[model samples]
Target: MTSDREQGTGGDLVATLIRTAGRRADPPADAYRAVLAAAEDTWQRKVGRRRHWRVGVGIAAAFVLLTAGAALLRVVVLPMMAPAEIARVDRVGGGVATRPAGAGAWVPLVAARRPLHAGTRLRTGPDGRVDLRLEGGVSLRLAVMTEVELHAPDLIRLQRGAVYADTGSAGPGGIVVVTPAGIARDLGTQFELRYAGDVLRLRVREGRVSLQRDAGELVAAAGEQLTIDTAGGVTRGNIARDDPDWAWAETIAPVPDFNDQSVAVLLEWVARETGRPVHYADAAAEQRAASVILHGRVGPLAPLEALGVLLSTTDLTYEILPDGTIEVRYQ
Candidate 1:
């Protein structure tokens, strides 16, 4: 029942749609595969980039953590490992300084009676000196412009300058001093070890000292001085117990308790310290010394000065001979 012109237009439109559909016959299977492959490649590229970024971030975080841990170890853990106390500072004079075992800024160490530990480094400035008492009644004395490290109760590293050690009358052989040149082993001795200008000097005030070196072992007896140069050259010299070279040690000698002590006791102490022999004019003089008792403190006077002051208090006089002999006589 449609009009003839409308029917004709509809038929032409249908024919044109059929021709267009035939020309576009469903996309080829190869083209569909290509599109899918392109999409997968694009996804992988984006994911790989993200994965790489994540890995970079992880590495950076790990680096930061390691750096912080190292800092913490140095700042906290290392300092907490306290050194063991093996000695005490009996006397510290002048510009004396102290530092920790391996690394630290030098700081003033002025207070006496301060505890000194192993691994402590001590250095003295001009006019500086120190006196220390180690285990076993050993006396350790440092000289001016000296640097040393307390390795143990019986071991010391003399880097520069001089150190004097007195192992007492019994002289238990447990002390040794080390230097760049050699090791000085204490054979129950009172000795001074000095290192300067690549030279190692050992002067035995009493007993003996031995050096263990790569070349051979050399022994130094009492009243002997051993000099070992950088070239391993050895030289021997004689030293007097009362030599002026030992005057420095005398100045820094620890003061003894003088209160209520006998004159005889005082004389013995003085003779022992001065490296001199003590004699009496007679038996009566000896009896008098033992009988008299001294009272009050002598302060920090040197051994000789205290002897003079203490003798003045009693009816006793003393004389020191050129041969390092002390003669006590009744006044």
Candidate 2:
């Protein structure tokens, strides 16, 4: 059933396709040449007796396979090696700026525009503060005029700024902050680490923190502060959980995802964030707190302010002591 006209048109199309592939495609010169040479050799040996048009088809098929494979790697493999999402800005106060991994000018942080990756440098303006959420429920807050580098998921370098961290009680996650003076690591706790000039301050609001330096390692428990100087001299002091020094951090504490949560959950969060121990006036109060549930957003208010607003809805009364202990009462 084959006709001369059909064979002539098909031959012309195959010849044009082979010539276009060679002229337009820009593949690896050596690889392209090698593949073409092998394909042509095979065509000559096996299809030598066949019509010349079939030879053009075989060569074009070889080029398609090569380019298709290269396209596959470009679409699939390259993306796998790109930087991953490591952190995100949860709260922004005033002016916050960040620089990417490469050397460049620090640009104003676009709130939630994109996820933050490691090696990114961020700093706050004189009146700026920010809260960043890392993987595993770790909260990092940067104070005004602080510069830090997100070195890794669990590590940050406090170049010359103050950073507060709160590792949630529900997880085993913690963060290590490195400074010129020493390295401070949290012990399942909420704490602050600040490096200013020749001094590095490590304050533990709840749980404990440890400092590792060239000389040795020292631990500071709750309500304790350790000042490490450039000369490596460590001085110990006391800082209350609800001290005025922590007011800035309190203002920027990561707001809980408090949707339809129990009153006890909010109470416990306030107590923990303010570094106050929680105590119920009686068994009835504890049970009442657990019974009541909350709805809607808490806004961006500080922990104490949010607690006050939420507690006013319920008949429960609460008291905060001088030592930062919060007592809840049903009456």
Candidate 3:
């Protein structure tokens, strides 16, 4: 019933349709490409998440290390400055007026002499007073009801209150006191400075006091004074003290223990007596046949001065602290 040409054309058409259906049942080239692209995207997302986690962990570790380093700086590094190293004192802050060595209330402007350590408590009543004197005779005195921090050998940061200073005889680099506002450098011999009420008050007695700002420097000479505000603004004038507070320096007593014992034994005794810590150089030499003639406080004073006196005794040398610890060596 069918013609030959019609039958052959229909068969060719059916064969073409079967071939197309087989290709569609499997995947086309574009479909393979789409699947590959999806796999790559998922891998990339996983990699991104891993990188983010690593970065976050790294940041956390860095934060912990930084915090630990700061604590070490405050507790260890700041206090280790040499005995010969110079220091400054200033006021920081306190919720109450006065706290003691265990109050955890105040921070010093410079490393404290025996009774003071970083974790020690600080108190300032309206009449609370504190003083710091470097081995080379630089001194800083905090007024009553003040708080401060001893940040470095030459750096002190005052948070609140007032401080008087006689920055004298610190070798070479001298002394520096920092406040909530600015820094005061000793170009002169003596100065009484107060950081309170957003004002830096300066009264110069003996030498010159230099008020330095980020912008410039203001020089105050003997009998002259200046005040600087938090804004780097400075005011200059003449200020004087009838009886300078330096009278305390005169009260420093001499060590008289050297009269009975050799300078070496004296140093050891002073170290044990005063309770200030001490270190020795050339321990054998310090213990050798060392003798000295005695004089005033240099003779009867604390161990530090006693060591100084012993050194004054022959070719020997020594060092002592305000708290009486002494270290000595014979030449």
Best by TM-score: 1
Worst ten-residue run, lDDT, model 1? 33-42
The TM-score between candidate 2 and the true structure equals 0.72
Please identify model 2 stretches exceeding 4 Å from their true place: 1-80, 110-114, 170-173
For candidate 3, the 10 contiguous residues with the lowest summed lDDT are 88-97
Q: How accurate locally, in lDDT, is each candidate?
A: 0.80, 0.80, 0.53
Off by over 4 Å in 1: 1-81
Q: Better model by lDDT, 1 or 3?
A: 1
Give the winner by lDDT: 1 or 2. 1
Each prediction's TM-score versus the true structure: 0.73, 0.72, 0.42
Give me the displacement of residue 27 in model 1, in angstroms: 79
- TM accuracy, model 1: 0.73
lDDT for model 1 = 0.80
Decide which is better by TM-score, 1 or 2: 1
What does candidate 1's lDDT look like per residue over 95-115, in tens digits?
A: 999996766699998988888
Return whichever of 1 and 3 wins on TM-score. Answer: 1
By lDDT: ranked, best first = 1, 2, 3
lDDT of 2 by residue, 111-146 (tens): 752578867899999999999988666889999999
Which candidate comes out best when scored by lDDT? Answer: 1
